[model samples]
Target: MNCLLFTWRKGDGKLKIHEVRKQLTTPLGAPAYPWGPYNFRNREYLNILYRTDMEALRRVVPEPLAIDEPLVKFEVMYMPDAPGLGAYTEAGQVIPVSFNGEKGEYLHAMYVDNHPAIAVGREVSAYPKKLGAPRLYIDSDTLVGTLDYGSLRVATATMGYKHQPMDLALARQELSQPTFMLKIVPNTDGSQKVCQLMRTQINNPTIHGAWTAPARLQLFAHALAPMADLPVLEVISASHIITDLTLSKPDVIYDYLAEH
Candidate 1:
């Protein structure tokens, strides 16, 4: 399990890379092994990659006792609201996004894993700590939801898991992780309530290899009492995996799976 860190600075447009090393040990007095020397530049990118690995561990691990090797890559794009968070520009690199929302800036982190974690019970300890709760909406069998961060809305959708077909396995898997939890919170305006919490293990291979479990929308009112009177608009979080890019070469993936 190698982890790469990609750091983005908004001012000068620079991307720095760093490698993180972790020791995986067994009970015996001998050396268990060294998992990484992963490359990355910052913490936000690390968080995104960590979440991806956590999801893979939960949904795709067919066996419990096996050890899997996954090659991972990450990219972080930061649109800073204020200075001093290490937002500096570099020569030749262009800023990937603009600051259009009220928040004034946004941070978008993208993670790509070539060989991701595929262990059933073996947990990846690198999951994110600041993920917001998902708001879930279902129309017939389709699953749709939004993740609200103050005034910002992150939208997500899930068709279902492969084995279960129509079942929302990704949502269930996310709800099942001990580290991940969901709760209803009032929105900034007292008018409504929204879901608040973080999620883990929400990926399924059957449906585009992407899935999201949203929090309940009504809870926003109760969670943020002071803002109950404010107008609420539906917003969507744009987090999703392009399966063709992420899960290409099924034969190769299966071959790697078989080797493990």
Candidate 2:
């Protein structure tokens, strides 16, 4: 699966273009910083693109096989930091995302399988203390769908940090809070067939080292949607359980790692 993660800081006032540029140019442990084009003069925003693989993804993801699509994408927007309540604003907003470097003003919608009692436990889970939990617009088991104009669907997923730990304390913290994992399946050809999969993260307070989930089931749906005459594949969501904890040192570090 080829996935792209895009992050945007609240450019309102705290994060200027220069600071963003410096952060990108001088990331904590990287010897050489990665830089990209940002309309700094206009103070638009900065974007960093990461081409990663499965082994790297498994470090943070609890369920990798559940996501089997080829193109996964996500967008993070910096919420306007309001005094006292600023951090809460960005808690559960689904910022638009472009996949495969495609961008434009497009229509987009979301469908969430609604389930009851799912929100009760998510309230304080690692989410920003100020923003609180999302509004619980729909149930997880209930199928709520939307129509949009974008070429791709960016989906996001959240595993209970307390339930599943991903080395990073912040991720664990956010997991402590109520977070939603998204699965975006593009709708084309006027059929309910999902074209591609897009993944993303939502309601995270801190901004660094964030990752996006893969769109595996969405891709499978798209492939199978066309052949309605064939037996439809069943996709199920299981608990976020992590097992087999082990650490092994690599024999050698390659100068460059290629994407599959």
Candidate 3:
């Protein structure tokens, strides 16, 4: 009989059989960072809330998350110094919802530059993240965000930067609310491996600056990230803010795969 040995590779070195690998995350293994300083600084965000089709909105929202309004928030964020995820730009669509009698936001789709952010976001926070090029930058006097899926541009948003100052206390209170997501991981047999509604909040967020302004949003119909599904009915509100926050741990609110 012959015995074989297996080893894993690390940065500039190799791991011996006896040495245990790091536990970063459960789903993807050692690469995912479970805990972090998980902090963000000078994180600039542009949020555009627009009214969408009520019937179209109902199709995507999961159970227990009732539509509070027919509004969806399209956000573009620039995280210059995110402790764990590093510097990255994120763009996503979050819908206004009510869960368990409390009003909150629900993540529908997200796109980011970094791979680690995508993996950990999906695994821990139940964020529906996909890899793409999303950027937030200042073009002339306007704050802009654009998302590109491959060579195709999916969405673009532009707003007047700090055109109107909002009350700081009011902004702080709005930033403290928890956000929800529907997490579904399928099994090899096409059944659900894990299905649940998750709740995660940005803890102790300090809004250093906030401003409200007129904004415009353009969403294209792409099969990969169909942002056009919502179909904007009216532009409700738009705002830009700079904040420092902590990405806190998540709590399971509802289990879809659980037995009755």
Candidate 4:
């Protein structure tokens, strides 16, 4: 199959072959998203790691990626100075898994409040990102993170703000690992045209401030955003971090379905 791109004329609405093969992204004249690698500064995070059931972990993590542990990382990010994506808040769930003996996190579900952020994330890197309401802020001495899909609450997390300085070196190492996700692009016939596992990681992250704290996480069942599908049995660890980093595109690791 061949890939073709075209646009419409201004007045008569005639089809114009204005395709630039190597040009960043699609829809020609007015691209909705900016081309990366995007830079971010003062990116704040409220990460709460929790334990879950092994059966639940196995159901979400795909094959070729083994479940390293029955653990899930519930994270809420506040991007204050993201260059291309603008300032937005995002929250998601990630699972600990290993691909071909390499340990990494599998991005299960993510929601952002920014339009461009959601567009770029889903189209560019194929990150499982959606447009949902997520917020991160400080309330009194607690760092709060909440996610909502429409009018229903999906998740809520709270931590003691700057309770104790975290191990920066360890935090940096953990953040450097590649994350795996599946990309599905459907064809006109309702068949999957592109189905593959993609790998992406933070390019270079500079941790400005990091801390560990006592935290709690509450996940509610939702129809659209089913984050609570992976139940939180116990909260393991929590971290609040401020960092600067760059976002890079993902590389296709494994093809799940091929057009024959």
Best model per TM-score? 4
Q: Residue 224 of model 3: what lDDT?
A: 91
**71 Cα displacement, candidate 3 (Å):** 0.7
Evaluate candidate 1 by giving its C-alpha RMSD to the native, one decimal: 22.3
Question: What is the C-alpha lDDT profile of model 3 across 1-260, one tens digit per residue?
Answer: 23354645556376454544444555534566547657889888888989999999999998879997789999988899887678998898999899879998999999999877888888766889999899998899998989998889999999997899989886776677679988888999999999999998876778889999889999999999899998877888888889998788889999987875
- Candidate 1 lowest-lDDT run of ten: 88-97
Write model 4 residue lDDT over 53-75, tens digit each, in one string.
99988888888889977899999
- Indicate which candidate wins on lDDT: 4
**Predicted candidate 2 versus true structure: per-residue lDDT over 132-197, tens digit per residue:** 122111134221111111233322223222223234454334322322232222346554322222
Q: In angstroms, how far off is 222's CA in candidate 2?
A: 38
Identify the runs in model 2 with alpha carbons over 4 angstroms from their true place.
1-49, 69-76, 81-84, 87-260
**RMSD of each candidate relative to the true structure:** 22.3, 19.0, 4.4, 3.2
Order of the predicted models by lDDT, top scorer first: 4, 3, 1, 2
Model 3 scores a TM of: 0.88
Model 4: residues >4 Å from true position, as ranges?
1-27, 258-260
Ranking by TM-score: 4, 3, 1, 2
Q: Mind giving the per-residue lDDT tens digits that candidate 1 earns over 1-260?
A: 24333444546544333212233444334432224322223211100121123333323222221213221111122212111212211100001111121111011111111112211012223221232333433466544433444454332223322213223354233222222222233456764343322222322322233333321222134342211122123322222221211111101111212324
